[model samples]
Target chain A: MNKKFLLLLFSLLALLVLALTPFIGMEKIPFDTILNFDSSNIHSDIFWRIRVPRILIAFISGSALAISGMAFQAMFRNALATPFTLGVSSGAAFGAALYVKIGFIFSLLGISGQTLFAFAGALVSIMLVYILSKVKKGFPVGTMLLAGVAINFFFSSFILFIQFISDFTNSFRIIRWLMGGFEVIGYSDIYNVIPFIIIGTIIIILLSTELNLLTLGEDVAVSRGVSLSKVKNILFFATSLMVSGVISVVGPIGFVGMMVPHISRLIIGADHRYLVLLNIIFGGAFLVLCDTLSRILIAPAEIPVGVITALLGGPFFIWLLIKSSNNNSI
Target chain B: MSKILFNIENLSFSISKKEILKSLSLKIYEGDYLSIIGPNGGGKTTLIKCLIKIYQSPVNKIFFKEQPIEKIPQKKLASQISYVPQINETNFPFTAKEFLMLARYPHLSRFSSVTAADTKAVASAFDITNTTNLANRFMNTLSGGEKQMIFIAAAFAQGGEVILLDEPATFLDPKHEHNVYQILKTIHQETNKTIVTVTHNINSAILNSNRIALIKNGKLDFYGNSVDITKNNILEKAYNKKFTFIKHPASEKSIIVPEVV
Candidate 1:
């Protein structure tokens, strides 16, 4: 608990840093300026409109991807399982892309159309994994992951197909979205996403004990006062929702989820009750640092936050995998 | 004089299209040290798995204390029955003590802090399993027998009404195997929790259990008191072998193992 507390405190300190990033760049941006400066000018516009929303979006999306990835990885007992691992990213992206191309058609539904459609897309892709996995009793981790991979491929091809035919005007936007970025974020994105993130994350945190029991093995979990079908179903959909909600707005960010949980597990045991909280805190800091590097290290032309995560996360995942295999006990 | 803790009636399970268990029915009463033994692919482990609700696939309509297993939430079921699976490959290298701490999981909610009572159970498990000194030792570092002891201790720490061991002694040395039986016997006697172990070690099963059931080809061949099984005729009939109920050649004590071919 002390270790977790320290991790949390450090994470809270990092969040403080993230909150300060817009004011800390090469330009003499100040916290006072953010509050007192007029919103009319280019500098103010860049800070309040573009940067604030983008940072919040990155924070929400990073937490969402990492937390959901932790849930998926724990449930599947697969380090490779991530927000994008099971094709949820591709599924949601495809749906959103289709909506972007056919915006005029969905404009018939009034406001919140594309985001809603994107959410639906993310939900549907997981639904595909669920349907495939649901066939033989409770969802086995192996089957769920395999289904996720297959769905990911299907959606990837679909995304490619959409990209291939998209006209000159929309091509650049589509390409940018595919590469993944944290720019041009809007307040609407925050309002649309923050509520779901809060609700979903709370439910998961509340059920952390069940998640811990699950780490012991399914039978052990069931025997220990957990209902396998109900909990797994709720957890699966809830996790998917968290990831979908974030990805629908800012696209997918990688590695924050995939890499952080294992490190926490390495620190603590496979106890989800502790792991979930630790992952959220550490994951937030880990992503904030990555995003900060993206903004400053590259200067005015910011690199996609996802790139930094992948570079760090991929190698870390291999090391953890080797460590887990070497020990050979879950 | 005993109450039925678990009742399985017409329970069926399948993997893909093939039926793993078919119309199997059995009733396990309280204080029954039951061992379900059979050959490979004989559904011994499968039956125990189903009873613990860890079958290859799910078993349909399992009953716990006359209530449907489906209706009983896992947390409550865990408070009543704890299962120790045959050791499989794992990635977490928990200490022997940490492994037993997992038994406290059922009694714990995600937000619930680990109480002293939970630690007490873990400590008790360590003491009973004779692995107290190995508390800080990594599970991966333990020898096969020591690891098995730690695993049993983990299951016992759950503090449930029943303990299910699925071949808990598999891959153990002779000394460790004997120790496992002794540990189970001590736990059953001291705690009065029902013990169900699945194994091929018929001798220990005979010695430690109050009753033994033969599970073969996904069916229960026979179920009776361990004392009754000492009868050569019944033993030979159920096992399809020749045997003599005699004392051990070296120890000069009652034993059931060596059979004539």
Candidate 2:
């Protein structure tokens, strides 16, 4: 198949999915009712107020995770890397859990305390990963990955400990947040996540060439005149900001990050120039589809979107592992 | 005498408090086909890295085109000198053309698209290295010889005046190894670009390079004409092994033969 044609077809398909998915769910919102602007119309209210914002949040969060995952994989030159690989999501979850335990109700500058704490926790985790990786001589990728996994375990245990000590109501709230969903009411979540996503996407696109070179090898990249440290720092900071922003809003959604980029790369080769954009479009559509399934699976009582992605993603991940081992390349 | 392209003044490099290159001073003249030869652990690769600023020497120690190496921006330095790294397995499945295009990084800005000149350079690189047929093939799928040719082609596409190759024929059959050297010789002769190669193939290095620098224990054991290598027991002293000199069948130049243990 022609690569450009394939890209265009997939892009159009993704757009179609994004366009059609907002009409699905427990509420039957007809096409005509979507055109009705009257506030009194319950169907219009549900379409505009509930479904649209939820889909937008899902699309944005998925796109952010997918692109960040793509960047991480290229940066580490490893296929298994994801947005949450460095425990940024776990760190943010811990922050939200701690906030719930403290019972903080204050909002700062129109942002909730939980979001702020989660962002802070994400930054803290990134800093710790950086410091830990620096303990080695040259910030080698193996050391960085091991450091990230260690930090991931460390934060996870802390989250578990916090959950253990909390009251039943708070414990339940923490568990619900950890499950990861898009139960957003309006465009507020959109506003909170859009800036980070936009900034991160732009940064990744700009450095797409460097990302391509880095994937070959660090020596090759440096020999080709890439400033390794500068590029790596920028990539880490951008991915952290983007991941933290989305995780703060939607809790720690998993598998979208790991799965979407891999799927995109499989369809399009590892040329990051096209891969990054494909990840955004396909990843967004994919999560919207998953979130729609979550909403309609049991009609009124919805399964968390995270559970659906994991259920699908786990098998896909194992299949990928097996395939990679067979070919000795991923 | 040709202008000096690179000048090293008492450059010393260390890693983890252990010195790897000890106060090495040398000058590389423009249009010089210089080969660096040494036994294992003799810092040949490290010297190439330092020349490209992959390993920074002490301040004011290494100079490129009379400017301090550290002061030169990496992109500018890259445009001036290109490197062909030792062969390693590439995991990514970049097509040969896509892989070669990455060599244009030093000449391109972030927003600049591929220009006509870039395309011409890449096409000419393929033409010169005779790898135009492999341009569409995935890099990982190519054999060692083909991959080495592609690496050389990438260096040509980079359009640097100087090409530094680290053991370009390390893991190839004799036919492929001879092909690599032939292409490099044609490139050096036709373009008059300075070529610095680090090679363990002592015979080929002596035959091809105009000058030879034999390093031993992080120091310059000998630096002189390639033919002069057979004089003064240089090979025996550097490798700590006895060698018998023999004349090449084609060119009648002196070549070394290792004595049986």
Candidate 3:
């Protein structure tokens, strides 16, 4: 098959899955809810207020994580590099844990204190990493990774400390959120995030040319006229914003960001223009399917979507390692 | 009668008190084929990096066509001088055509897509480097020599008068090494490009470059026409070892051979 045609077919299939996901849930949203809207439209209420927003959030947040993952992988030139590799997710988790443990009653713009704190934590961790990298003459990748690992350890210990002191209910809440969930969200909750995700993803797509050159190496990219520092800084902030926004709301979903980009690369190759778009489509569908499975697997008892992804993603990751080791293509 | 294209004057670079380049000065003409050769860790690669402004130089020290190099925007400078990096493996598997298209970046605007003329340039670059068949192949799947040729083709697509190459044939077999040099020679003669390459391959440099720049201890110990290189004992000084030159049977270029005990 032609590569373009194959990509299109895959995208359509993913879209079909995404579209069909809302109707297959526990309540079985009436298929005619879209075409009929009377005053006492219970089906319309379920479809519009709950199912639609849940799927939209799932698709948006999933794509956000995946797109950011692809960008970070190129930035660090490491396959394992994800948006969370630099401790962004850990930092957010710590903040959310702190908020829950402290029982913070404050809310900004009807947004919970936990979400606000999570965003701040993610940004602060990235800022710390940025500052650490600036101590060197060039922003060396190895140094940044080491610093990120250090910060990740630091935040994880703090989160554990918070968990130790919290009451049983608060600690349980914190643990469940950390495990990741896509629930109880409406369009108003994500209205602001939509703009940031759209803008960030679009900007990354436009700079796909530079992203392609960067995979060759920093020096090669610079020699090709890419302002290395400018591109790096822009991508860092954009990726941080996107990742932080999703983690703040959806609570740090894992595996989708790291695994989806690699899967897309294996399927479509590593050109970011195509990779980014395909990831948005395919990655969105991937999490919707996972979320659907999470809801339906236990039937009225929901497992965290994050756990479902890990359960599936773990074997895929191991297979990738074995295949690469056997053939050494990676 | 070629005009000076690059002028380096009293330039120096250091990292944490460790000097990589001293107060070295040299003039490169518009269409000169210059080779920079030195022993390992003698700053040959560093000099190439400095020339391309990867290591920032003083405002007036490095001039491009009599204008301060720092004044040129990165995009404009790239269009004037493209670089071919040493053959290295890439984990990302971009096709050769997609990889080559990145060379057209400096000519492109932020939001615009690649156009028909850009495709023509890429096609012509493939023709020059004899890499048309490899266009659709994944970059990581190609052999080292093939990858090197594709990079050179990318440089040609960059539309630069000056092409800086860093060890273009370091890890290739003899046949591929000769093939790479032949492609470079054609680019130099036919396209009228100023070629400056850093190489440990003394014979290849001597055969392909019109002039040689010998670097030692972060300074240029010799810079002259290739024919004039044999008139001095600079090679021994540059390497801190004894050397002798032999004539190539066909090209008649001097080949440097080390004295082994």
Candidate 4:
């Protein structure tokens, strides 16, 4: 099949999924009520206030994670690299857990205390990774990855300790947050995450050419005029900011970041120019569909979207590994 | 006398407190085909890297076109100089054409699409290297020699006057090695491009290059015309081993063979 044709077909399917997913849930809101724009109607109220905002957040967060994952994979030149590979998600989860444990109730700058703490945690992890990697002369990729893994483990253990000491309710809240979900009710969550996604996507798209050269090797990228340190710093900062923002709002959703980009690459090839756009659409639709399934899977008792993604992602990942090993193309 | 394209003045480099390139100084003139040859662990690769600014040389140590190379922005420097790194296996699946297109990075502005000039440069690169058939093929799928040619084509597509290659023909069969050198020779003669290649093949170095720089133990052992290389036992000194010099039957150029004990 033609790659462009596949891209177009996948994009159209994604658009259709995005358009249809909001209407799918435990209680189906009719398309007519959604189109009527009658906020007073109960069905319309559910469609406009509940489903729309949830889908919007889901789409935005999904795309953010996917693109960030794609960029990290390229920067590290490793297929398994994800947005959370550098511990941003773990750090954010630790912050949210700390907020639950300490019983913080206040909001700052119109942002919830939990969100603020999570973002702060992400910044700290980024700083730690940066400092650790900088100890080497060249800020080697392997060093950065190892540093991130160490930080991830450190924060993860702290979260577990916090959970161990907390009351049952607080422990449950932290556990739920760790599982990840879209329990959003209004437009506020959408407002919180859109800026990071837009800005980070722009930065990544602009550097798509550099990312292409980078996948070849550092020596190749530098010889071709990429400012290695400068590009790496900017990409790292942008991806961290985007991942931190999304994870802060929606908790730490796994698999989308690592999985979507590879699926996109398999579909569209590894050109970041097209891969970025495809990952955005495919990833967004994928999560929205998964989130909708989370709503309808058990009906009224929502399974965390994270659970659904993992359930699907683990099998898909295994299959991908097998397929790629057969062809020896990752 | 031709203009000097690169001037290295007392350049030294170190990593982890271990010196790799000692105070090295040499002049590379425009249109010159200079081959750097030495034993393993010598600073041959390091010298090529410094010239391409992969390793930052100290200020006033290296100059390109009479301007301090450190002062040139990386993009501009890349536009003036291109490098073909030692070929290695890559897992990336970028098509050969797409791979060639990335060579246009120095010439492209952020957010701008590839222009007609960029396309023409890439097409001409394929023509010159005679690897257009490999354009649509995935990079990793190509044979080692084919990949080497594509890399050279990428260097050509970069549109730089000077090309630096580190071991352009290593790990290849004899035919591919000859093909690699043949393409380099054509690029040099037809385009008048300045080429600095690092190789362990002393015979090919003497035959293909006008000048040779012999580096050993992070220092320059000799810098002179290729024909003068055999006169002072420089090969023997650089390798710390004995060699027998012989004239090539075809070109009558001086070549050397290691004398086995």
Residue B21 lDDT, candidate 2, scale 0-100: 86
User: Which candidate model has the greater TM-score, 2 or 3?
Assistant: 2
Q: Indicate the residue-level lDDT of A312 in model 3.
A: 78
Indicate the TM-score of model 4: 0.94
TM-score leader:
2
**lDDT (Cα, 0-100) at A127 in candidate 3:** 79
| lDDT per residue as tens, model 3, A1-330 | 456886799788987987787787677676777667663787777777777798888889888999988888787676555767678888877877787887857877765676678778877887786677667655655567577788889998998889889888888887888888878646875774676688889888988888888887888888889888889889887887787778877787877877889888878877787888888888888888889899899988999998998787778756765665543323
* lDDT over C-alpha atoms for residue A254 of model 3: 77
TM-score of each: 0.88, 0.95, 0.92, 0.94
**lDDT (Cα, 0-100) at A230 in candidate 1:** 84
Ranking by lDDT: 2, 4, 3, 1
| Residue B7 C-alpha lDDT in model 2 | 95
lDDT of 3 by residue, B122-169 (tens): 999999999999999988788888888999999999888899999998
The Cα local distance difference test for each model comes to 0.73, 0.86, 0.81, 0.86
DockQ of each: 0.52, 0.68, 0.59, 0.68
Judged by DockQ cut-offs, the docking class of candidate 3 is: medium
Candidate 4 local lDDT, A75-139, one digit each (tens):
76665556576787898788878988999688876767777788788778877766765677557
Residue pairs that clash (backbone atoms under 3 angstroms), model 4: none
Clash pairs detected, candidate 3: none
| Candidates 1 and 2, the one with greater TM-score | 2
Q: Residue-wise lDDT of candidate 1 within B57-144, one digit each (tens)?
A: 3444677888877666667777777888787655344566666776787777666688999999999988998889999897667787
